[model samples]
Target: MRKWLPLIAVCAGSFLFLLDTTVVTVALPRIGADLSASVGQLQWVPDVYTLVLTVLMLAAGSLADRWGPRRTFLAGLVVFGLASLACGFSPDIGMLIAARGVQAIGGAALAVTGFALLVAHYDGRERGTAISVFFAVNGLGAAVGPLAGGVLTEYFGWSAIFFVNVPLVVLTAVFTVFALGRDTPARRGRFDLAGAAWFALGAASLVHGLTLGGEGRWTSPVTVGALVVSVVAFAAFGFVERRPEPLLDLRLFRDGGFTTLVACAAASTLTFAALVYVSLWLQTGRALGPVAAGLELAPLAVASFLTSTLAGRVLHRFPPRVLLGAGVLLGAAGCLLQLGLAVPAGLAVTGIGVGIAGPATGAAIVAAAPPGRAGMAAGILTTTRQFGQTLGVAVLGIAYQAGGLAPVYVVAAGCGGVTGLLALVPRKQARVTT
Candidate 1:
């Protein structure tokens, strides 16, 4: 039991961090009604959080390695707690959105460091077990976030959803401190602040352009300018990362296994974007309430949780590439299933695929990282996931508007099928040494 305490603390904190990613969806209507926010503002509430979280993920991992995971994790808890408080009390949409951005900053820190800490503490079979549990809990949080948000919003108002994080974060912090103890300093390293800035700017600009374009601003100068900025900033980022002591080590991408796993991460999370459309189908197309919609989505979470455990146990016997290919194919089947009469089953099936794929891919990426770079590898994996979600929201969102929800599912199915086939391509064994 004592030996398991650190995993508990790490997973708990990670759960809180990831939960906020989707929890806000069910409360958007309430927030708009109370705050009188515009459609764009409502979208920003979630998009900004995602944007900040993705932008800072690599930087957060660097900080964790430089300062030690324990300190970085604790600081993130404090920032997230304080930001949640601000979010809960904000009187207007702008304030709430701003607070959410702050929350994402802390969330990125906790997310990268929390997983890195787990990798640090466990190895071999034990490491696989810990990662599977982490993925399961994280998936569970994301799956139930909407339901939890709806229940809290229904009973205690939307503010309650944000406030709920406060206590949970506080408890996690306490447990984390007790279990992880003080941070011991590692060798100090140079932080490429300029490269980080360029990356953040590039990512934000791209997301902003895509979002605006999706929202009927395609012809707007603001949208065009954002696109241009994204291109230029990304070019600059590429140049900057080539320098020594760059914020993100570019050499990490040379490993084919890590690169494939990153692609797998993006592919798996693309389905996550489909979840929003599913909720919309339930609420708008089917006329279900938020709570009911969320409840209907529960099967996805339950299936994922069970399958994650199954994956953990079976991973030892199978090479990661095989497990990864199977998981992706399962997800493809799930997406294709949604096109027919088996909608709920499709969602659950996709959850099962995600359960197997995510942990397997993550473990491969972590194993492929160079010595002392596990945090960076974890950051890259999550960054790809966030990138996929952002793309899904922007691109699929447009498809939903133009062709309705059916076409959106078709696109998702196609993406899953292609990625699954790609995962089957033979690759050298993943590098697992420090």
Candidate 2:
């Protein structure tokens, strides 16, 4: 058996990070009642966390590589735990949203560091095995989230969700420090204020556009202006990345592996995005409760956890393209199946297919990054994935409002199909990507 202690630590971090994202959905109503938040305020409660994490996540990766994963990981744990406590005791919606943003900042550090360290600690087959285990733990958190949230909300109140995170954070931090030891951390030395500012603003503008999209007028002056700003900021970011002593390494983009990595990363999140919509369909349109709604998503979680381990073990001999392609195809099939869901079985099957697809796609991306740049690659992918969620939320919400679920599902299927084709693109092995 693998010396599982280190991996357990990584998995623990993942569980805490993701647990907050999904489990809290069940408690939103309770939270709204307690905080007296408007619908928009309620939406921001989760969106703000996701937004902050996606925007700064790459910076966190840079910090991790410059310093050491161990240090970054531990810092994230402490901050996230404390933030969780703050969130639990939030006196108003604004405070709760602020605390969520801070929690996301800490989560960004842990996420980037965890993936990178696993890449360093495990190699070849073992590496994949470790990542699979890490994600599986996350799947467990998601599976239990609604039940946990419901129970906590029904009994202890919505604050219980935040309170629950406190102990997990402490336990994970203690175990991580013990497992990794007290090595001096690596430092990236200098902060890239220009790069961070430009990138963060770019992401903020883009998400702002999407958030405003729910109100209609995706092309209104505000939305269009935000999009224009995003374009300008990204253009500026490209310039900064090309400079000497750049914050992010652009050379990684030259490698074919990197292309595959980005595409696959996008695919992984897209699959999850579709899953999010399907669950929304079940809960809102069908009026299913949280527990039943979560069960509908369980098949995907199971397939992802199980296949991630299997993919990790077989990745070398099996070409990543084939695996990722097959997985994408499965996801596309599942996504298409999702459109036809009049029954829970249909949703679950689609989720299962997407679950199988995610690990293979992630494996391909992981294979693309060089060891030294692994944290950077993982950070970029995580940010991309998070941003994709916001985009998915916007796009599906718009499509649903404008054309209803059928059109939205059709659009999602088209996206999945397109991504599957990208997966088949004869891409090189995983390597460091900018």
Candidate 3:
């Protein structure tokens, strides 16, 4: 029992952090009403968290390398707990958005270091088992988020969604301190402040611009300016990463396997983001309450949990390309099934697809990394996924507004098909376990 305490601690943190990614979806209506928020402000509630998480992930990974994963993860818990408190107490939309951004900063730390800690502690068959459990929990957290939010918000009020994290954070922190092994000696290196800044600017601007576009402001000067800034900042990030010890090693992209894994990571979330809009449609369009809407979406969660658990058990036996390609193709098919209000059927299919790809994607990305670069690899994987969520919500939100659910499903399916094809590309070196 004691031997698995660390896994418990890490999974607890992973569950809490990932839960926040979509937990707020069901509660958005309640939050908007209470805070007197506009539709745009409501969208920012979720987008802000992912945007910040996506931007800070690389820096957090590098920080973990410098400070050690244990310390970094502990720090993340503290920050996340504090941010959750602030979010619960927030009196206005702006305060809530700011607090959520802070929460993502903590989430980024937890995400990267948690993967590093798992890699540090487990190996061989044990490693495969640990990662499978980790990814299963990841799927569970994401899958159940909307349901949890609905129950909490329907009965306890919307603030309970954030407040619920307080006790979990406390318990997880204490368990981690006692059960997790002490960190290895920290790596010595100069932190890449320039690279971090450039990446942050680029990502933030890109998300902001997309958000504006979603709001039917594509021709607005602010939107155009934000897009332009994103382009220049990304260019600068590419240039800065050419340094010997950059924030993100540019050389990682050279590996076809690694690149494929990252693309799958992004696609998984991109397709999953449809759930947010689906939840919204249930409540606002179908006139269901929070709990009812959440219940309607339950099949996705159930399918994801079962599929991820099964995938974890066999994760070590198959090639990543086969698993990833098949998983994403299924997700695309699921999206297509949702074309005409077949919500439950489409979502369940999508859930299975996401579940199948989830563990394989995580294991492959981390496995493909060179020694001592697990943190970087994990960070890149998470960053891309979070960015995909951010982009999906923004883009899908636009699609929803323009032509309702039809366009949203079409766009999601199209993207998933392309991503699935990319994952099918031959990459002989991408093994999940040794």
- Highest-lDDT candidate: 3
Encode model 2's per-residue lDDT on 290-380: one tens digit a residue: 5666666666666656655555566566666666667666666666666676434544544454455555555666656554666676777
On a 0 to 1 TM-score scale, where does candidate 3 land against the true structure? 0.97
Q: In candidate 1, how many Å is residue 192 off?
A: 1.4
Stretches of model 2 off by over 4 angstroms after superposition: 142-144, 184-189, 255-257, 274-280, 430-434
Q: Write the number of the candidate with greater TM-score, choosing between 2 and 3.
A: 3
Candidate 3 segments exceeding 4 Å error: 428-434
TM per prediction: 0.96, 0.90, 0.97
Candidate 3 RMSD to the correct structure: 2.0
Which is superior by lDDT, 2 or 3? 3
Q: lDDT score, residue 151, model 1? A: 86
The number of clashing residue pairs in each candidate reads 0, 13, 0
lDDT of 2 at 269: 55
lDDT tens digits, residue span 18-85, model 3:
99999999999999999999999999999999999999999998888888999999999999999999
Question: Per-residue lDDT for 7 in model 1?
Answer: 93
Query: How many pairs of residues in model 1 come into backbone collision?
Result: 0
